[model samples]
Target: MQKLTNTIFLLFFVAIGQGQALPNLDSLLKLVPAAKEDSGKVLLYINIGQQYESNHPEIAKQYYREAGALSRKINYPAGIIKYINNYTFVLNMQGQFDSSLLLNKQAVEIARETKDSINLGKALFNTGTSYRVRSDFESAIRYYEEGKKVFERHGSEETQAIANDILQLLYYSLEQFDKAIEYGTAAVTYLRKVQNLPFLATAASNLGISYARKHEYEKAKALFNETYNIGLKIHDLNAQGSSMLNLGDIALQQSRYSELEKYFSKAEKIFLELDAKESLVISYRGLAIYYLFQRNYPVAAKYGEQGLAITNELNLAFEKRKTLETLSSIYIAMQDIEKGEEYLRMSTRVGDSLLSETIQKNTIEIEKKFEAEKKETQIKALTANQKVQQLSIERKNFLNKILLAAGAAVVIISLLAYRNYKQKQKIQEQRIAELETEKKLAATEAVLKGEEQERTRLAKDLHDGLGGMLSGIKYSFSTMKGNLIMTPENARAFERSMDMLDSSIAEMRRVAHNMMPEALVKFGLDTALKDFCNDINQSGALKVTYQSIGLENLSIDQTTAITIYRISQELLNNIMKHAAAKTAIVQLSHSEDTISLTVEDDGKGFDISILNGARGIGWTNIQTRVEYLKGKTDIQSAPQKGTSIHIELKTS
Candidate 1:
């Protein structure tokens, strides 16, 4: 089974309450002609747009555009923000991620400039939705966390609940079931309190999925039943169909095969009537899996093929992969080994393509985030400069007024005042400089955090998704090896092929580990560093001597630990790639509030002054991270002599 299709629609219901009747579109249109070109008219346009949003989005877009133009003409920031929020939401629903993201970012800028916290929070959440739809989970989580904080502080209970709902789904996507349940429970409780049937059903369904993931089957079932009943009350076909599909999944997990056909059949019928191809795909796949378990290959194959057809038509790579796997199982059960293997290969190819796409998208998003931060920092600096100039002008005007009011007696006083003003202005300029540095550091921190999140995501995808597929393929090949009767030459060739497969698996594991070492997360920084050094030593690329002090029983935050680990990792990688190092020493120590790291390598080195001119990404990244920690870096290297680098940071 798949996630509920009603999840996206929850945003719409949250924005426009389902409890109240929608405004009459014709009445709203008639009112538009007589409405003044003011904020009230902007709101009227929005209301009319909302009336058309569900059934006629293109018409809704037109109205929203008119509202936005009017709001701009009136110089109404709130109206403009609202217009962007509503307009981009429709864009997001239409799969125009680029346009939605651009408009949402604009809304954020406008809201920030106006100091409108409520609208700012809403814009942030909407921007996160755009990233989430594009499968940029790292960026999505970052924005979601920011929006959650804003809503908690300034937004209403309903808005806070909506934020929690979005976070729950995001965590669920990350496979962080515990976090998902935490947010989901909060959202469901508030949604139920308000008796918002549409949102409640969706929230409860999501909460149920989290419970189901945690193997709390009873809780999941109860939630699913609640959602189903809510759907019946609201007469929401999408909710009903989704709930039925979820229940079928739960039944399959619990080995209650008898219930599968009933739930799946009902879901299929409802989805077909509603013309929801995505939900229908899940329904078909569920029936296929049910029949596959029943040993009825023909029936299973039929449903699986139906799902595959829809997935292909929709160009849904993820769903297509699942359907292909189901069909492969059906064919294999029917003793059609050739077709089974062919389908299996196709599934693997699709999975690989998805994995590749994910990596490419993450890379692009990281660059985009960095550039966005840079632009924001520049804007802030310019704004600060403008404020300073304005303050100077106001001060000068006041001084001129004092001079004009008095005679020569005011000349001496004016000189003294001007001297004091100059001093204060200097201080203010220094303060602005400090603020600019802080902003730059903040931007660097965001980029580093984004990079780490991307690495973790890629590591998980590689280790869990592709790793399992490769392992299964190896197992299948091994099984076939025993069943085949081959000549000695063919057997030797098979052995070589097996060896190559083993190498590939090992290489993949190595790459995954390097991306994000499990040791770094499970053990403390000291142990993770030690393990990394040991791995390098075993590889024989460099002999790394690791030393630690005052870190045995010390506790460090995850962010700090990750930063330290990456610094060491990058230093070592640079050593191997550029230093031609035979051996290196990595020393880490913590005393009181300060931590120090020293790396010395016995290899050919270049002039350290070269870093002053231009540097590679690795060197730039190291400098950025060190600056982000508010630390100091000292490097000593020249000609063929070895290089030594030391960094120190205050943990407190």
Candidate 2:
């Protein structure tokens, strides 16, 4: 995983050359002779630098420096930002984190002053990369998140996707697989849509690593294969090698020894040919695992030692830990007990150090978030106090004017003046009451919006995060069943547990769907309602018929749609639980300036008088939502009869 970081960084540079065809070195040089000293020439130098960036970074730096100097002479901020962006990339590749950070900071300042949002986003992302390389995960994530917002606002979809890819890799490094998959999925989707093979290959390969970590071997394999094919199409050896290495890792995990040797050997050959030392470390580790699985202790130890040496030289703590563990295993298998124990102790120490570092980084990130939130709260409080003081001063000035005017009046007209003052005070009180009402409405709206947002977030977490984890656990248990020998009683208990697990997963999905239905967000209110009714029908709880009118091409706002859906949902739930209902009807209709919803059920109903007093939470919630929409609700019900509810809201 640590080695894959370098692979992704390399692919990011390769992506710079994508989207358009670049002129050959000779063609660029030929234009240089006739080019004027302007921004165009500055761009030409940067473009030329990009050509040599991957293979000859020193030469790239020379061209980048020339561009920067020329841009400063011409007072071209964009050109200077571009120069710093390209230059620091090469600096990062050469392990010059401090220099890269300094240059990127300068670029950020210039971009900000010049209002170059696109360049600012690039600078922020580059700064994040430098921090990531220095193992400052908290700072790296902050910059990446900030850059993602800027790109979303001002850059293209492709640029935003690129930012997603970078954040995905950073989160993956922190072992946040769910977050990684979320961003990585977005990046892969866009890259594939645009047919950007070079970028797609790398993004897919990186995403596959996250899936693989979650024990989803099949999905991981498919992505790696996609990466390999894309790499072949784009002539990206690094992509090809990284994918092969990842595939080999999957094979090792699944104990597919024959495929392991083939994949690892191919990866090793590619990395060796490309002279990618960091990637080669992974290749060596994979081969060692393959050999160890084959019971060839000497060969396994040989490859493990080679990987350990490179990890030590490069100071890759994560990879070093893994290599040490592998060598320890090989020595133990060969009966070198003392040597095995020595290697085991070293591995433990390395693992402990890595764990400690991760914990410290995470702690720093948490503390930073707390402080930011605390500061924001303080600022809001201060602003509120200032508003209160201003309002108090205005009231005092108004009273003083009233007192002066009353003193100026004659005693004979005192009653008239007093009456006028009393009337004005009454009007002001009415106005204050109206303002208080408006404030309450605003607060309710905020609460509803926040509730919906939280529901959506929770739904995503359940479906993508917890759901995947549960599925993985079930898969592991199923796989273990075939490998284990158990008594009949134990087997029966295991079967029961599996059944319970399946039920739990189904219940989770149901809960998540209720929280936020995917159809509601994607297709719209009509389709989502239809799906909900269909699901109820399938469940055999009650027959629910749904219909919509004047909604074929009409679009409803999300808040209104969700409110209507929830109202209908609550009505149906009550019918299922309390109403001895056999059938129900849900109808939604929209007009030019209004929307209407009607729900009816044939069931034993309660007296309508009961609703005038206290009601259950569900009924109260329905009433609250209707009030929030400034809508009218009509309910008709009687004992031994049916119930019907109608709601109408102004679309205007």
Candidate 3:
């Protein structure tokens, strides 16, 4: 029953308009014949399709088909995309998951080509719902999260609410009940605020299911009643039917047999009238259980068989297994041992088959997702490689031009050799100064290496020795606390001492981690940088945004990673300490033969020439580290404008 729960979530969509009357289906049909052959006609067909989507799916599909044909005839990609997106909802209602997925993917491509992000979000949300229906929960969750972000950015609260509702059901399917409740409750709240009563009822019904699973029956009951009232007020048959089924389920659980029959009978009548087979299965299952409890073996068996048949037609493996189990119990209660045995065996087979199919499908979906990601990565890599090659060619051309000019100047220099003899003395002095500068750089590198070595040793000592001892002491204090009897004041003091020790231990670990991040030593630079930025952001200090690519997979040596990490750390520290920045961005990117580090902050800046006499150790460290790596650093700043520092290092 839980497996079948929320399965029909994809069947209904939140209608867009508020406070506007829906167009009559007959009126829209009449106008379609008189409308001109243009985008307006296409939109009319779409509107007709939506009007029929909830109650008359087949008619809706036909209308969407006509809309699509008209759009293509007019060479209107946007119209085609719109119709396809609407059309997939019908496919979803019919349980045509793979077909719906294909159409949604096509819609995504079309939306992208048109650069329509709102439509793109809709397409992605539809795709995710299709995947959720197919039990590809990983893909479903990824797309839903992405689609939610896009909708939020575009201020499409209606679509966002729809996506959130699907995510709630998806998380419930994945057995992540907390996340299910969170998303489900949020969706209901938002839908209620927007007065989308149909979807608000749906979301509340879904959250009720999740709460029931969590054994929070009081909360579940409240949600179900709320949905039922809203559904009745809106005259939404689908919403009313679903809420009644849920309430009937709750009544059955509570053994309120009279209330159960009343709810189930009403829901069954509604579903049967609408021919909503997907939802009718729920009523059948509830009736089967209700009749079984009343000792009506024949009626219970009949209802179970009906639900089983519908589940089979829908290819709902979990629901089929549930029905089989219910039937087995019914026969067993009736003393039909042979029939019970047969049903039990059928249930077992269905369960095993469902498990196997789920595993296979999940494997295939993961492989497909990874393969697509790999292709995208390769394309990006190729593009970056082409850019690098183009720069190389340009640099070579520039060098050749310079060489030609130098060759022309050589002839003139030969004629002016005596005049250059005086410049040779100055050239010799400059050469000596260059040598001295090189020696100073080497000395700085050695000093930096020593400092790093000392830091490493100190970090190790703190983590392995002091940290361990502190942890042991804290544990000992905790163990001693329960055994010792003291005055109330003494107990309070003892608790304070233990708390202080815990804080001390935490501070020690933080220091050790900063000195030499364990993630940097283990998972490499990207994880370390991300962790660092996440910590800063979590601290409620300056917001630090970090983005890195290829650092994990590029196979840089440890020394290079640490050097680059230290430079970045110094830059972030400078921003936090003196930049007065509200936000900063740290981006580390890598190419085939080069790595670039960029740190920018929206803060008060200084003259670019400040480095000439600047004494700040942070800036000095950044420059020294870059020099040590034989890299170049560019610092751009103005008195009031923000600062940006870019460092590029050769991999070789």
lDDT of each: 0.80, 0.79, 0.77
Clashes of 3: 0
Q: Higher-lDDT candidate among 2 and 3?
A: 2
TM-score to true structure, per model: 0.63, 0.53, 0.54
The weakest ten consecutive residues by lDDT in model 2 span 12-21
* Native-referenced Cα lDDT, model 2: 0.79
Which candidate number would show the highest TM-score if scored against the true structure? 1
lDDT-based ranking? 1, 2, 3
487 in model 2: Cα distance from truth in Å? 32
Cα lDDT tens digits, model 3, 486-532, are 99999999989988988998899999999989899888888888999
Question: Candidate 1, residues 39-84: lDDT per residue as tens digits?
Answer: 9999998888866664466888999999999999999999988888
| RMSD of each predicted structure | 8.7, 11.2, 19.5
Instruction: Compare the candidates by lDDT and give the number of the best one.
Output: 1
